[model samples]
Target chain A: MPFQPGCRRLMLQIDILLSALANGLMTGAVYALIALGLTLVYGVLHVINFAHGATLTAAMFAVWAAHDGLGIDPYVAILILTPLFFALGYALQRFVIGPASHGSDSNILLVTLGLSIVIENALLAAFRSDTRSIDVPYGFSVIELGNLFLPLPKVIAFFASFLVAALLWGLMAHTDIGKAIRAVSREKTGAALSGIPVEHVYAVTFGLGAACLAVAACLLMPTFLVNPRVGNAFVLVAFTIVVLGGMGSVPGALIGGLIIGVVESLSGLYFGESLGQIGIFLIFILVLLVRPAGLFGARA
Target chain B: MTGSARLPILIAVIVLALLPLGATSNTLLNFMTFALIVALAAQGWNLLGGYGGQFSFGHAAFFGTGAYAMGLLQVRFGLNPWAAMPVAMLLGAAVGWAIGFLAFRARLRGAYFALVTLAFAEVFRILANAWAFTGAAAGLLVPLKLQAANMQFEDKRLFYWLVLAFVAGALVLTAELARSRFGARLVALRENEDAARALGVDTLRVKLAAITLSAGVTAAAGGLYAQKSLYLDAAIAYGPWISVDALLAPIVGGLGTVFGPLIGALALLGLGELSKMALGNLFGGAVPGIDLIVFGILLILAVAFAPRGLLGLFDRLIRRPRPAEGGEATP
Candidate 1:
């Protein structure tokens, strides 16, 4: 039997909207995870880690290496890789970032930018610019709910993002080390005076930030392809998210990411892919113009 | 400004001007032409990023706009390249002013301002990629017209001379600006905007003017680049790589210095070519990213060791003797 044409069109429109919303939420979760790491480091160190995306790319490469070479699952690789990355981040802060901290803001910015270029180009040299992806058992699996379908990998990534966020919240709220980090972020001199080991906290906070990237990379491996320039593709979006979410605010990152994800997905559906980016940038410019402090940022 | 300071620059310019006379290699001339064009763009960037202290991460917008303006006019409208060049530069300045005005009015500073510029560039890139008039991802190609008025030449030597003239003009302009009251105001703003404001500096107007001038000059370079390459694509014109190149040269040499961009362009491009050669020799094949790795390492070292750049080191060396001379006079 032929259905009513108008009714069928309406149903299809609803389905499209629902799908876009669902995808937006999932993508937003990943964006939030990435931005959270950036915000954490920014909040504590007062330095924008321009290499945040590069670190994410490095972590993704690490996951791929373990999975491809050792036949380890990506999830399992996360457990091993996260700690290693944390140590690497710790060392980076202690050595490279520590010295530059005394310089001007531009100095720090340029140093991080240079580091990003180094990591990205090093990866390009090593990997030869080929796009790689992991194939988990559930990579293509999907869940059906009424008129909606959800990709399993995205679902897993979404939940993983939340799980990590929750863990970070718990760590920050309850742990002694977390308190020290908070103290340092609030006032380095005061934290030092109070015997909180401010320098140590800075290193550890940066390490934690890198560890978050490791988790994000592990979660993203099943859904996104990895390449030397993949970080470049996402870095701008992460910056947008951080700015939208009030720079260093943890909850703000989550909210900002979701908003950007929805805007991107909806615009993509309506206009096309490239214009979707324009849409996000439009929003970014608007945010900068209207409220440079961001929605959740503390008033200066 | 001083005779001592001007002497080396004069000597360098003379050497560069006479280089093509002895050299017969089209390859070398072409390389120098590209470097000089980049130097021109970098000089423009230096006006804003170094002197005005507004580090733009999205100069590609102005560049791409200029390239596209020239390409579209020449291809679609059948306009003369000479006519298109100024219009394109004006368009670039307009866009720069718009972005600068919005950012400055909002009082965005440092990283926030940088990111806003990046956003504008990305917006342009996306538009160029998606718009049919821009030929989408296929890009627009300039017709192969070997005419001076068209800004195209049969010989690379002509292009080299053309680009060298522009680079020299930029250098002279920058030098003049450096010694001017406007330049002093810009430097004051860079040192401390609040303090500059307290001293009655029209911070916003100075910044806008600097950025507009910077964008206009960069756009002119972009127009020449399009004519030379005969192609206008989003990636080539508006890519982040272009912005990086523009800023990198000034940073590597010495931000806010008149001769910095020229020295930086020579250093960066020369190093890039040398590294490519070295890597090709070692690997026995073309490795695509070795130059970038070299550049990255160099930039890191530059930032870490010489935050003020190579010219800073030279300044110290030059002034060392002056202090010694003063001590001798005192004794």
Candidate 2:
């Protein structure tokens, strides 16, 4: 009977590990989606979009608003919000970011940082710091795969993110606009010389990045709470993933995201939540120290 | 260093020192003290961020370290505030040196460097929140004792004067550093790291020194802040808001200039207070995030119209009639 308790404890441990892994994968998929947006913008702009997280938070609020106001499904809100965010991104890049871009890198950094503060505070002013979340019909439904449990919302988010990633990959590989964006990213002057309209490409690329955030917000809203400062939590993780994935590499973002997710889950399980952040940050520093170019990044 | 410059700064300092004699309101004294403390920290930030061109997004780490050092020493070990401050500053310098070493050795540049610094602060924050020695988010409170040696004063005016001394020291140090050989090397490294390295500038050493000095000064300010507020917590000390205040001041005033942080701090703190009061009156209570909204707009406008800050704008205006002496026009 005493030995039986030991056996049960081992089984419980295994189950916990498996569950953490599963949960991490789901969360990592979303992280990859966010990091992909960041990496894409960095690839073209050569300026870190400090407001990337704020943009995601803004979109999440829009999704929440649509769901509450019109009874629109969170899934459908993605379609509406994506286009809206894309246009917003286009205008932002064209009018605001474009003008600021003329300055040094630090200038652009300040500009974006300022924009992030503006967006975050504006949201706070409007929303009154209340946490908001959308309820889906199948929000609480869970699927039992043997002893492991999979929440339906998380599974949907994971799959949706995966699908979008695949679609983005395909678009980048097989589309004319994608090629132009890549061209501009590779060589702005060269792209312009080739009559690629680099500025327009920059706007379009930024829009796509923002649209990716919209998709992520849609997937995330079913499970996570939305707030003005919600993006602050995710932004650093996204940065870690982007750096790990080799700033401009799509596949790298996915791998980095998954690694960070697993790290977060495992650390959270063993060392607690705050230490998990410390663990991730340590890994980030280690990666920067050992491999500044990143695992999949081309040498700068 | 120049007579004209020396005269104006001396007069300004004299005026600020004498103003409290006429207006002895606690509110004004408190505001001035806070602004001066911020100015001290901002000047520290300006050394590394503006002059060195190493934008640290996680300066909260050093600031927090200083506060925690002061808090921990005074609260836990019963160390005197006067002695604890220099120790806190040394701790800050050590932390800065360690961070700078790792980052520079890894050859992390630009945004990567910024991110690493941010991560350091975040890690420090998490640790501070989790550790019982830090009082675990409950925070450590300094015992209220009106002793000069304890660095606590019953009168807000005393605190104001104390902070003014530190701010003046920082301004002097910054002005001196701006003309030093080490400062030139830092600026050189900032402009072109590889070129500087090739020129035997010891770029890493220069950067490390700058960061260490910057961190030390920032920590000193943090110590004063802890003494002033008589409190130290993860959020209060290590939060992003602290770092934002440090960087924003120099950016709004004029990066790479000794007086920039002072001007920026006054403008920022002034505007913040004014807006807070106005918004409070309009809304019948303090609106939580209005200050940040105003700050963001101002930052955006500053970047757009005056990237060199108010000082740079003044320089441009003053030199407009004598275009020949304007030298290299700012981009």
Candidate 3:
């Protein structure tokens, strides 16, 4: 039975509960997008991409530049920035990280770490550590569901995540390049022997990952503010999601992100915001300690 | 340990000791003081990463623990700073042992171990930032009492000599480890854990011991930092910046060697000051991050071009190849 909003105080808890879940879902969608990119790269490269946060920061800056300088809407800027970021990611992996690493795991790790340091410091130098956001017309708009109101930008991001994930799934399932990517990630030597230009496939995978980050950055700019350090917070959460989702599993990432999001939202409701961040790390540590394979364990 | 092999370390320490007598510029003293502190921290890292081949990504966990212990014991409980320093190292060992036990028991190695350690450091940072016992976000500051007993000195050179003493001690310890039976087992495990285990090495015990000692050594550096700076914050103590520094020094100097951290710290931080000066001149003011950008480039270049670090490069330049001794300083 539906209770009247103005009539009863008992319904307030229920309202808060529902609201937290709704916010969790909305936030989870963005996390899913971020983790998807990380998972894809981890799947193919077999090395953690230490520069993932810096790359996201760069994409956020691009969106901010397009809006603040050129007057393009954040959503409209996504179309231009996604492909641009794709090319940038492709070039970075194809030229810098590839040759520098020389196919060694430890070398790759160091090179990526170095790359992150460079990118982050460069952003700090250029941006002066200022928080940036797009002042959209619809930034304040909200949709009312019963007694709960959800912000419209979050609502848009939630659905956009579904669309992107579906499109990515279709691409992986049906496209020739996608087949090559899967083959390469599964067996590099075999894929190369089977005439799949392995290096090209690696570059393509990196590009797609960066494209995902661009879409995520665009969706985020309307509601969230950007600074050089902001992406670092998300990077840790995204890593937790990847771990929970079983490293390289796409569906696992989406579901794991939603679970973590709900957990984070509820913990924030209970604990103070700063301390609540610890909940994510606790869950991550527990997952690593208790079940290294993860609950999903689909493709671990 | 052979006296001839330890000849270089002796000369280096003596040179460092005499440096203040010859040229006591405050800038140079400040740089050397900070560099030696980093070298101590890097020595802690090299014990596990370079010797045991663990490659941790969250050494800040140990460093911060040490710093916080020094702060809380002094500020809250009114413990003497001298006593608090050792306590910090003890706590660091306990923390390291706990993490090592859980991780090694689970058989997590390589990247997984690194990730877990990183997560642990984040947990500590968040707790320290928010918890009241550690003074919350305002951070803890040591009492500004100028006395040798309190480990504070007005002259600054006394503190420099004190840090060099600690660094010298760490160098001797590392040099001793190169010839010790424990170091042999550690290097054996690094080469191949399965082979070492088959050859009767207690792999788990050795790793745990290495991590515990590593944490203690690193914590000592943290304690010294708190004493020298007279302040400690969650970010300052527990940040990823320190963790990177702890790793970078040994790699740039010469991995698994006694003097790697000291040489690496001086070279790296020296380059850092050079960049800062250049950028300051160019921009006409203090500008952040130009040096770090240079550091990042150097890290990549070092990995790609000189895997054995500056010491190895020097060795090549001099064309002096030492005999293959036990526990050669190479991965």
Candidate 4:
């Protein structure tokens, strides 16, 4: 049973790679979901929506508190929270965010950044800086498929990402409201002149975007340890994904999301832990160079 | 010069210059130095973000690169501080030139450009954490003694004067830039890119110039910051806090105006110190992430109510007449 040094080294390398990939995918799926909302808002509004990450974290906290404090299941909490988040999103867009949108892109960006700060800090103040995690009854369960093992929570998160992305795609491609959104995205005054309720579309866009976070939050609860600062990790990756997927391109978000997930996964595995984020950012820069419009982005 | 127009500027400069003399403690003086460096950073940021209209969310890259350039030269190569700073600026300018070339070439304007820059900063941070020469996660610490030319001074007042001098230099430089042909081109590009391009303005060249200069100024601040803090690390250099500080100053004061970043820095830094003082009392333990919240809220309010910034608000309160009203209108 004596093993050669080279063989042993190769075995260790494989193990590290697998672990890094596993972590990257698990985290990247959640990142994709967050970016999907951001991408959606951008697709319609051409605004960065810095609040996207904060909203996701806030919702994750909401789900965590509901499940932990109130003894409600995270899955069930989503149904209760989706509507509430939508309304909040609607009000935020209609009253405060939309008015700021009238100026340059910088104006919109600053407003969202501000909103994110408010949400994040308020969460920090209320929840304190301690990390929060919900213990799903079956959170740790994993299925063994040959050489790889997939955790139950990650699978759930992946599936949630798929479902939400699919639904968003459907809404944009197959629905009347989606058409209005697309119309508005093309030309605002033109869309308005054609009797499209521009304001309603903007509200709905933000609401749906926030609603995506609601689903992401629920899926995220059992897996990632929720913290006031969790949004910081997600923001950069989400931004990269949105850019890669094309600013407002919907299907691009899905494709961009998956590509990032895989890259994140593989990079972590091949490289050390520290190189994981740097690896993703390199991909982001490369993609920007190779395809300015994103992988599947429509030509500007 | 009109007394009304020049009065506020004069008063503000006088107040800032006298700040260190009145301060008794090193802590407060240190804070003022920190604020001044950040204000310098904001001014640098203003060149790209405010005037050029290329909002960058990730300026920490330049800051970190400058610090590291100097740090690496000093520790690894044993170069003098005076020799290292200019070298750092040159290196910083090169990196800025590269990033700007790539991003601008891709037509990554506005939010996308901002994101790319931010991502670049994150990359630098991760690299800083991984790289061996900079001590990886432990960070690179440059030794400091009472060497004036080394940019290290035992006296807080001396350090304060150095930072104040840098601030004045930045202000004069920015003022000069704002009046230059390149500055006019920047404004034209900002106001109407298509029109500027049509007018045969080399838009990309103008942006590159602004960005390179911005990076140089920011790098100088980073060098001074490394000396003053006596600790240069990836987190301190490339942290989101640095970016936020850079962003907030210009917004609070005014984005494009010459004195905006300074005014913004003074206001935001004062409020931030005050808030910490007030909140530190209410909460016994370390109150983490509260400043971030305040920064975010301030950004929102600035964008929503006064996109033009505090300078704009001040102008409004004083009811200053426009050049049109002063018989400068044509046609």
Which candidate gets the maximum DockQ versus the true structure?
A: 2
Model 3 agreement with the true structure over A1-300: per-residue lDDT tens digits: 465655566678889989999999899999999999988988888877878888999999989999999999989988999999899889988988887877877677888888888889888888878888889999999999989899999999999988999999999889999999999999999999999998889888889989999999999999999988787898889989988887878988899889988899999998869867999999888888877767676523
Q: Which runs of model 1 end up more than 4 angstroms from their true locations?
A: A1-5, B1-9, B318-331
lDDT (tens digit, per residue) of candidate 2 on B63-138: 9999999999998999999999999999999999999999988888888888899889988998898899999979
CAPRI-style class, candidate 4: medium
DockQ values of all predictions: 0.54, 0.70, 0.59, 0.56
lDDT (CA) per prediction: 0.86, 0.88, 0.88, 0.81
Question: Model 1 over residues A175-272: C-alpha lDDT tens digits?
Answer: 99999988888998899998888778888988998998999898889888999889876778888888888888999999998888888899999988
Q: What would the per-residue lDDT of candidate 3 be over residues B19-70, giving only the tens digit for each residue?
A: 9888869988988898999999999999999899898889999999999999
lDDT of 4 by residue, B1-331 (tens): 1113345555666787788777788788878888899998898899888888888888888888888988889889989888998898888878888889988888888777877888888888888887898878898888866778777776778878877878878887787777778988998999889999999999989999889999888887888788777677789988877777888899878988888899898788888777777787898765766666667777877877776789888887799656553211321
Candidate 3 has a DockQ of 0.59
TM-score computed on alpha carbons, candidate 2: 0.97
TM-scores of all predicted structures: 0.95, 0.97, 0.95, 0.91
Candidate 2 C-alpha error for residue A156, in Å = 0.8
By summed lDDT, the worst window of 10 consecutive residues in model 3 chain B runs over B322-331
User: Can you give the lDDT of residue B206 in candidate 1?
Assistant: 96
| Runs off by more than 4 Å, candidate 4 | A1-30, A144-148, A173-176, B1-14, B284-286, B320-331
After superposing candidate 2, which stretches have Cα over 4 Å from the reference? A1-4, B1-5, B321-331
